[model samples]
Target chain A: MKIHNFNAGPSVLPKEVVKKSAQSIINFNGSGLSLLEISHRSIDFLEIIEKATFLIKRIMNLNDDYAILFLQGGATLQFSMVPYNLMNQEASYLDTGFWAHNAIKEAKKFGKVKVLFSGKNKNYTYISTNYHIPCDMDYFHCTSNNTIVGTQMKIFPRTSIPIVCDMSSDIFSRKLDFCQFGLIYASAQKNVSSAGMTIVIVKKNILGTIRKNIPSYMDYKIHIQNNSILNTPNVFSIYTSMLTLKWIENQGGLSFLEKNNQKKAKLLYDEIDQNNLFENKIHQENRSNMNVTFFLKEKNLEKEFNKMWKKENIVGLDGHRYLGGYRASIYNALPLESVQFLIEIMKEFERKFS
Target chain B: MKIHNFNAGPSVLPKEVVKKSAQSIINFNGSGLSLLEISHRSIDFLEIIEKATFLIKRIMNLNDDYAILFLQGGATLQFSMVPYNLMNQEASYLDTGFWAHNAIKEAKKFGKVKVLFSGKNKNYTYISTNYHIPCDMDYFHCTSNNTIVGTQMKIFPRTSIPIVCDMSSDIFSRKLDFCQFGLIYASAQKNVSSAGMTIVIVKKNILGTIRKNIPSYMDYKIHIQNNSILNTPNVFSIYTSMLTLKWIENQGGLSFLEKNNQKKAKLLYDEIDQNNLFENKIHQENRSNMNVTFFLKEKNLEKEFNKMWKKENIVGLDGHRYLGGYRASIYNALPLESVQFLIEIMKEFERKFS
Candidate 1:
């Protein structure tokens, strides 16, 4: 069966990336050793880490001021780590979705987290922009894309405070202004590659500000000093992410990915808007270009629609458990054909139901 | 060129485990979806988590009273979490090696950590047997295997205090009595798969004892309550580890691994002892079956010997930067043939050097 995955995360990856990653695990770079079994400190494995970091900078057009690091734990860990490292006195946050809320919760542990804006009133259906960025705050935190509610901050709010983004779902989908932010992090399973690595890009000058005695692993300065080799890293995950970055480069980098992403998102959203049987709840301006969420006119028809999609070998279309409906996450690696096929299925369903 | 990897960790993994893990990353279990691209909350991924936990329990013969958790942040993070959760007033530590020192450092932040015994006087050359484990301490902490110094505790010290172990390097290499310890954690890169996930086995009753308001991610109680899915986990690392565990099962379980490990370690150690050109520094009784550290008989020949080994495609044999010499790590997945080949090369080197 030809399955088209619509999973929000640990989500779709490039076929080439998958094939190459599989081969590398068996005999990485023809070393005749499994990628899983090599020391992270070995020259070969160091090359993997170096290449992964180098490519992130290359693809993102990040300057030397930015240091790219591959850390474990996940964006969730970063939720706490960010505050532990950066949030000394106060931090500003925009509560965009579940992830943002979690980040806020962690930040509160360090100091006062001023929630400048939140979409909680709309049940997290849209991005809240009515906010005042406090100058006194150390940094402004936001989730660039909401994976669950399917909304995104299309344009980042202007803030003098260092911008810290949890771009778990939307990183690499489009070109990012590395200069505008002090730090940016994303879990690899979404747009990068797999679930075992978290990519952290931090500006060099931001270290040593935290007054607390941060644990060595969580401390960005320690990781930076050691060159992200403080401990044995997820070698296979890093290698696979490197492969994904190479694939991205081959596909013409971020500019190319943005076009494809926009096209895929537009196709799905256009179908939902044009068809009377289906409707997208998120305002079009705030709708995520990555996760397109919608529901049929008859809410009870969700089960039938989900079953139909599954039969068509379309998986992971079900919305988050907290939010019932369908969410199709079109990350960078997800091909346009998969989105087109999904649209065809939606069209067929619309014709049948109408 | 064929490479012989003796990395401490991200160490060697079974070739079969690597191949299977790589395949799953592209199209998991014939689902036609990349494992990297799937949701951690998806039923498919949930099954991976469940099966991974179940397999660990079954293979280890763990009782139902212990909860096996797949956590992020590696064992370093666990150092803080363990003390945070278990230390009410004070804790006792056996300072055996680098890891033990790190654990104690983290524990100090939480509360008073009483050092029961330390090998620091001898530069951590041997595990200490003479120590008074304080009954007043909340728990006694120790590292089961020391990767850097190449030493293992021949017997766990008898103590009234609850035992907590960092079994990072030697987990799954032998059978363990789970009931003896309150908690045992191994970062999955060594004997399991990669370094993104930490396997934590904690007693259920130990929860809620700590006085501090632990961060949700750092709290064992919350992770246990949520079944280690407190947030999106390192899905790919866990899934690969599951494959490795399955491979272990196929290879006649822990007993088979133990026997193979002993045989492999003995071959290299015998070669080191009988040959005048090479010598192992640790006391034979305290030698680690996992990491076998050695040095050249003639100090001047060390660099030449390392270069010679590299030319033979035997990589990662160089000792840790802090401990200059050579360390051949014979992890579980390391083939007997690789060890035999290393012995052959060693014999050749000895004949030439002698």
Candidate 2:
């Protein structure tokens, strides 16, 4: 049976990407050496990173003002990096869920972080647009999508201050105006690429304002100056990301992916509302298109329902440890058929048990 | 011609490791999901990491006092993290080569750094072991191997302070007591795995001493507590490292590889010493077994020598830009035949030119 992968981040990637990356590992571009063996500064890898950064800007419609950096340490490192590079006086943050709060926790170590709003009052069930952005703050920080609670910001707060976003979960799966944010960082384990690399797209002017001796690894300016080759980078990760970006571009960019994602989300969320056996707790409008989280109405059905999905060859359908519900992360590469297949299983479970 | 890869690193991995890792990228352990697509928290990956860590301790014979952490951001990140976590007031460092100097530079930012001795007076051609490490310092930092100038420290200075060594190039290629150092960090692209992952084997007690709110990513204690899954790690790189380590064990562990490495080094260095057209400036005792550096007696022969090697399908023979000549990085995976193959090409070139 073919496995239907609904894993969260480091989740499903394109089949073609899988095949191509696999081939490269054995003999990279007919170089007679494995991709694991070539120098990062080689002409082959230099072109790969260069093309990968070029594709990121082209797909996102980002201008030259934005410096694209392929960094390591995941988005967790960015929680500290964002404040270290931008927060001189203080920064304002909107705590959406676990990761956003994690970012806030790290930002506190660097300087003052005023949480403009938090979703904790309601079990983080909805994305609040009610928070007012303080104009005097250094930067307005927020997570574009919260994977844990399945809440996504439908609209970002308008502010004169530069907007910094951690879009680790739902970056390439949606469309947004490119100029609305000053900084954006996403872990490659999501819809972007394999694990081990982080993409940091920042407007060049917003950096160098903070009065701190930021370490070279944390400094945005240093990475930009070095073209992300300040040190030995994750060459294989960057190459894998390049293949993924090429796949995304070939499928007609964000406009096409946005439509594909919306269709998938609609199919899964509709099944949740119609099926009495399963219930979704997240607010309807704030529901994430990338991840659909729903729980079985009768908690005792957990074993049977899990067995049903496993027997049907579905994997990674379990929700995050933070929330005790089922989550199907329909990323950019997750086929619409996977969602349809999952719905069929949900219906089958209802037919037998309900 | 079959290429003989001599790239410093992201250098050659074992052929078996390359093939197996490539297969995993397509269908990880017959799970029908690409290794790149699986969650780091999944049972398969957790087992992979657990086994990888277990094998590391077994191969090195390190006791429970050491915590083996699979991290990202390479050795450069460790430059900052080592000081951020261990250097309470000050640290003493031996300035040996480019990367060693980089560690000292980053350490100076975190705490007072005293460079006990620098090889820059003689152009980093030798490793100096005569430097006095201050016992008052929190740690004494040094690099076990220098890939840039091709020098290796055959003996580590005995110090009362914690010894933190950056063994990026020659780790796992030789056997050592391992208990002599408080911390040892190595980039996986060298004698370990692919790029994007760093192996940090640190003593458990030496950490938690620095009086600072260390960032989660930088804190060794946090990583140990979380079992190196503190955040989303480079799952692919870790898996590849596991494969490489397993390959090492199957090759009769470090003792066998040490003999193999010495044989390769002996063959190449003997050829370099005997060749009338070539010369090596490094102190004989400090020469690296991992990377052997040699220069042409006639600088005008550069083009002809480059042509000869390229024609023979020898890649990455070019030396570091900092100190230009030639470098043959005979890492653990590089076969004795490849080194012999390089010697044949060198003799062929000499027959035509010398």
Candidate 3:
């Protein structure tokens, strides 16, 4: 059975990346050693990390001032690390959904945190654009994409305070002006690599101002100065990410990904609107191209809809625990053909019920 | 060439484990989804994590009182997490080697750390057993095996003050009384899985006593309550570890491993003793069965020795950067034939030079 994977974060990966990574696990670069067993300090691994770092800088159009780090723990760790390293007195945060709220929660432990905007009252179905960016804030934080609610920030708010964005789901899936943000972090499972690594791109000049004695692993200055090899890193995750980036680069980088992403989102969103049986919860303007969420208009049809998708070998189409319905996370690796197939199923589902 | 891998941590994995892991990466258990692409929340992954947890307890003879957590960020993060979670005001640490020194350095940020003994003066050739355990201290920390200097603690000191040990290098290689320690942590790269994962075994009752607000990801109590699914874990690393543990369980568990480990260590140590070309660095009683450190009697023979080993397809025989000597890390995965092959090469080099 051809499985259509759509689980949010730790989601689908490029087929080529999967194949190459598997081969490397058996024998890494013909070195007669499993990728799972090779030293991170070896020449082969050093090249892999260097290439992965270089590709991120090149694809994102980031300059030399930015340092690319492949660290362990997901975006959750970054929630504390961002505040621990950057926030000395106060920080501003935009709470869009679950992950953003968690980030805000972590930041509160470090120093004072001011919430600029929150979409929680609206069930996170929309993005908030009308909010004041506090000038006195140490940094402004926001999640670029809300995975659970299926809302995405279409345009980043212009702020004088150094901007820190958690682009976990949307990174490398769109074109953006990289210079505007001082620090950007993304967990690898979404559009990048496997589930264990987090990629941090930080502007070097913004660090070291804080007086707190940061833990060595969480310290950005130490990781940057040591070239991300301060300790034995998650080598498999980093190497898998390198293969994923190679795929992204080959497919014309973010520009190509953005176009395909738009096409996929439109195919599914247009069907949801046309069909009477289904309705998207998120506002059209704020709809995420990565995670397209919708629910059946008739609640009783949920069981039948789930059975139909499962029969078709579709995985991870169910919604999150907090929000019940359906969330089809169409990451960069998910093909347009799969999206079209899903649309066909949706239309058939509506025809039988309506 | 069939390469003889002897790299320290992120070292050799059992052939069966590597093969199975690679297959899983392609299509996990006929699910038509790559292990890399499967959601961590899926039933497939949850079962894997549960089984891995269960086996660790069963093999280590740990009860429900101990919390087994498979976390990300290697042992480097544990150096801080150990103190951040357990230490209230003061802790005692044994300065065994490079990693031990690093642990002490990270502990200083959390509390007043007292060094009971340091092996630095003796080039970390021996573990200190002469120190008294401070009654007032919160915990006593030590490294069971030093990879760099090739020393292993023959017997752990009987300490009442919550004993904390970093068993990264020699974990699961032999049978030991697992109940003697309050907390035990090991980096997965050594005798476990890949580099990005860490295994933490802590006593459940000891936590929540510290009033300090530990960052959620670093807090053991929260992680335990959440069943180590606090965030998106390194799925690949965890899965790989499970496969390795399965292999260990299949091979008659730790008792079988202990005999094989001793045999490999004795074979290499015998060669080093008999051959005048090479000399073992550590004291005879303190030598690590996991990592055997040695030096060439004549420094000029280093280049020839390197060439000879390279020709035989031996990898990771080079010493750590800080110390210039050879370190043969024969982990559980390495077959006895590979060590014998290395010994053959060592004898040949001596014959050619002598």
Model 1 TM-score, 2 decimals: 0.96
Fnat of each prediction? Answer: 0.79, 0.83, 0.82
The iRMS of model 3 comes to 0.9
lDDT of 3 by residue, A61-98 (tens): 98899999999888999999999999989999999999
Query: What's the ranking of the predictions by DockQ, best on top?
Result: 3, 2, 1
- By lDDT, rank the candidates, best first: 3, 2, 1
**Model 3 CA lDDT for position A5:** 87
Q: Which stretches of candidate 2 lie over 4 Å from their true place?
A: none
Which pairs clash in the backbone of model 3? none
Q: lDDT tens digits, residues A222-316, model 1?
A: 89998987777777778888888898999999999898899889988999999877899998789999999887789877777877788898878
How many residue pairs in model 1 have overlapping backbones? Answer: 8
* lDDT (Cα, tens digit) per residue for candidate 3, span B80-155: 9999998999999999999999999999999899999998898888876889988899999999999898999989
Task: Tell me how candidate 1 scores on lDDT.
Answer: 0.85
lDDT: worst 10-residue window of model 1 chain B: B206-215
Where in model 3 is the C-alpha error above 4 Å? none
Model 2: which docking level applies?
A: high
Q: In order, what are the TM-scores of chain A for the candidates?
A: 0.98, 0.99, 0.99
